[model samples]
Target: MSSDTKGALLDVVKGGVVSVTLFAAFLNLPVIGLPAAALTPFPALYFGLKRGNRAGIGLVLLAAVLVALAGGPEASVLYLGQSALLALALGWGVARGYSASRSIATAVLVTLGLAAAAAAVYSVASGVDLHERVVAGIRESISQALSLYEKRGIKGDELKPFRDALEQGGEVLSRLYPALLLIGQSIVAGINVMLLRRFANRLPAPIRIAPFNSFRNPDYLVWVAIAVGFSLLIDNNVVNAAALNVATVAGFLYFLQGLAIVRHYFETYSVPALLRYLFYAMLVMQAYLAIAVALLGLFDLWADFRRPRKPKNL
Candidate 1:
């Protein structure tokens, strides 16, 4: 075989190996499992950007087959449908030289679309309410925990309050799960893109992504957020639920934009690196502060906090 052909084949092999390792880590790891799963697409993304799309897709198929053989049909489908497809979108975005914001948005949308499709398919096939199943699983877990606590001699009033709280929590979780899921999957895709940026220059095909600190969402999104907020006043369960989901997603997106604005000011003012780290820590630990940041982000659309003042002629 020609030297070029041999090198291409080796790349394919390498991509397959990386995919399998990451997928295995995703399946086997416990607390860190989601992060491990998020990395499953990186191999295919790298190869797709480096080689042609066709070759990259071929590598993904090979990886999926390997996963199916080793982990079973369910594993193969999950890896292919979720992680593999995400990687493909990321690779396609980078290869086409999309901006960092656009690329990340594309990846997040792809994740949401694939996730919705999978859930719909599963719901139809099983004839079960997915939300109810999830809530039931949560309740079961709470029940098991409470039982263990009871067995350990912590019954009576102490357990009663906790049990009530846990049940109530489960109900809230079921109601808000759709929003939670969207935020979670978006975060996963966003983080993966951030991580991938660090290695982009070292890959076979170098791609430069703008720093996340400079990211911004369009201003028109604010109107959608306002509409969703108004919908909350309506009494219809369907409208309220739909509004809740949209509002939650918009809130998180604006929070990110707010963060970027903070980063910009810190950079512009030459703020100390340590202080910037502390700022982020405070935002994460304080729920109210995070909400405040989101408000700042939304208001920034009109406030124009980041706009530079024009220099006056002397």
Candidate 2:
């Protein structure tokens, strides 16, 4: 066989094996499993970007088949939604030379659409309300945690307040899960794109991605934020829920823009890498700090924090 054909076949095998390994780690390894899950798309993304579309699709299918054999059809579906689709969509975007933001957005939207469609199909087939199922799952998880806490000797009155708080939190989670899922998928797409940028030069053709420090969302998204804010004032539950979800997603985007501005200043001032890492850790650990960063990004529209003000003509 031709060397090129042999190389392609080898890549398919390698990529498929790596993808399955990552998925398995995600399932069996508790501490690092989440990170492993996040990286599950990388192999397909890398191979697809390096070899082409068919190689990427082949790798994903192989991984899915392996997962199905070991787990079930449900697990394969999960793999497709969580990793394969994102890998395929991102590969399509990058091959067409889309910008990093555009590529990530496309991948996220495509995955979300497909996932929603799948959910709808399942709901129809089983005559089950997915929303109630999600809410029940959240409550069940909380109940298990509370049970563990009770076993640790927290009883009656003490546990009552804790249970109340957890139940309330579960309700909020159920209402906002759509937004949370969108933000999560977006993060996954962004992470893969950032990783891809590191290896872009190794690909068969040159691809350009602008530096993250210079990233900015479109100016018009601010208007959407304003509309959503107004929507929250409405008394209707549906409107309020929809508004909150939009706000959550928009807030995440602004948070990213905020991080870009922070990075810009960090580079300009040559901040020490250690300090940068600490600050990022703080952002993750402290909820208020993340909100503050998102606010900083929102205000950047007027402040132009990264750019110097043009001198006024006398």
Candidate 3:
């Protein structure tokens, strides 16, 4: 066989192994498996970045076939529907040399749009309210968790109040689930973009992205937030919930912006890496501090917190 043919065959085999391992790890590991599972897209991304979209799609298809062979048609469809789609989106974006923010934004919007469509289809086919169904699922998962905890020796007074609080928390979460879903997808997209960018850097020509400190959303987003904020005053429950979810998503974006601002300042002042990490630890440990940072990000539109300072006269 020619060298080219051998190389192609090797690539196909490598893609298959990566896809199978990633999917199996995620399937078997459950709660702690997501990080490993996230790497499922790496093979596709590698081909896309190094070769092209054609190679990436080939990898995705191969992954679907492997998944189907191992787990059946249903599992294969699920993989194609979720993981494969995301991999293709990310890989295509990287292959095309899109900026990190734009790539992540595109992938996230695609994910949200696809999820919404699936929810609509499921609701129509099942003749059940999608929101309620989701809430029910969450409650069921919580019950399973509680059962596991009891099996592991958590019981009586210790477990009772914890269970009660968990039940209530689940309800609240379900209500805010739309926002949570968007946030979750955004995080996933961000991680994928970061990973892809890191990999791209090792290539002969790396993709360029705006510095983290300079990250900012378009001005129109603030107006959308304002509109959602106004909608919150309406008397309808449905409207209120919709507005709340939209606001929650906006707030999370602002939180990210705030973090960028924090990073910018740390870099500007030449803050020690250790101190910067400590500050981040505090943000994680203190809810109020985190909120304050997020608010700063939201207000940055008017505040221009990162504007350069003027030099003193001699």
Candidate 4:
């Protein structure tokens, strides 16, 4: 083989090793495991963007094989669905010079499609409904949590209310799992994209990435959000569930818009880094603040908070 071919192959192997190592950390580590898993796609995405599609695909395939050998077929499937495929989608978009939002949307749609197809195949092969299975698993987890709480004392009436609340929450979560999955994968894609942008300069060819503060969803989305809001008034459980899912997704999009607005102001004012970090920390710890931010984003449609106001006549 030529030296160039040898170098490409070696790089692929190195990237694959990094991917698997991150996946392993995600599986084995406790608190930091999730963050590690979130980054499992980075190596493939980076290599693909830097070296080309084949290198990225090689990294992903090699990593999948390593995962399957170490963790079994199911784990390999999980890695592909959760990490590899997303990397491929994001890498494809970024390499083609797609906008950040467009790239993330493409990644989300592709991953969601793959997830639905995988669920259908699993249901068919196993002769079980995937939705029902997910609900059952959720309930099982709730039961385990309740048992743990009970073992820690607080019995009788306290326990009864807690159990009831847990059951209700689990049911809601089961219903919202699909929406949650979308939001989650979107987050994963966004993070990897941001990371790629941040480090893109290190690559041979640096790509242009628009400032995050400038992000804005299409205006038509507001109408859809309004429609979902109206649909929530319907009494039917099925309708309510579906509407809730759509609203949840819409809310998340608005929340991101709101964050972009916040970032814009922060940059305009040259906000201190420590204050910005604290504000972000508060957003994570205070749910109401997040909702408020989403509202801010929504109202920005009319308010145009990001737009510069013309100087008032003296």
The candidate scoring highest on TM-score is: 2
**TM-scores vs. true structure, each candidate:** 0.89, 0.96, 0.88, 0.95
The lDDT for every candidate, in the order shown, is 0.83, 0.92, 0.79, 0.91
Per-residue lDDT for 92-177 in model 2, tens only?
99889999899999999999998899889989999999999999999899999899999999989999999999999998899999
- lDDT, candidate 3, equals 0.79
Candidate 3: segments with Cα more than 4 A from true spot: 1-9, 126-128, 148-157, 204-206
- The true-versus-predicted C-alpha distance at residue 170 of model 2, in Å, is 0.9
The stretch of ten residues in a row with the least summed lDDT in candidate 3 is 196-205
What's model 1's overall lDDT?
Answer: 0.83
| Model 1 poorest 10 in a row by lDDT | 199-208
Alpha-carbon runs more than 4 Å astray in model 2:
308-314
- Higher-scoring candidate on TM-score, 2 or 4: 2
Q: Rank candidates by TM-score, best first.
A: 2, 4, 1, 3
Model 4 ranges off by over 4 Å: none
Q: What is the C-alpha RMSD of each candidate to the true structure, in Å?
A: 2.5, 2.0, 2.5, 1.6
TM-score of 1: 0.89
Give the lDDT of residue 10 in candidate 2.
97
Better of 2 and 3 by TM-score: 2
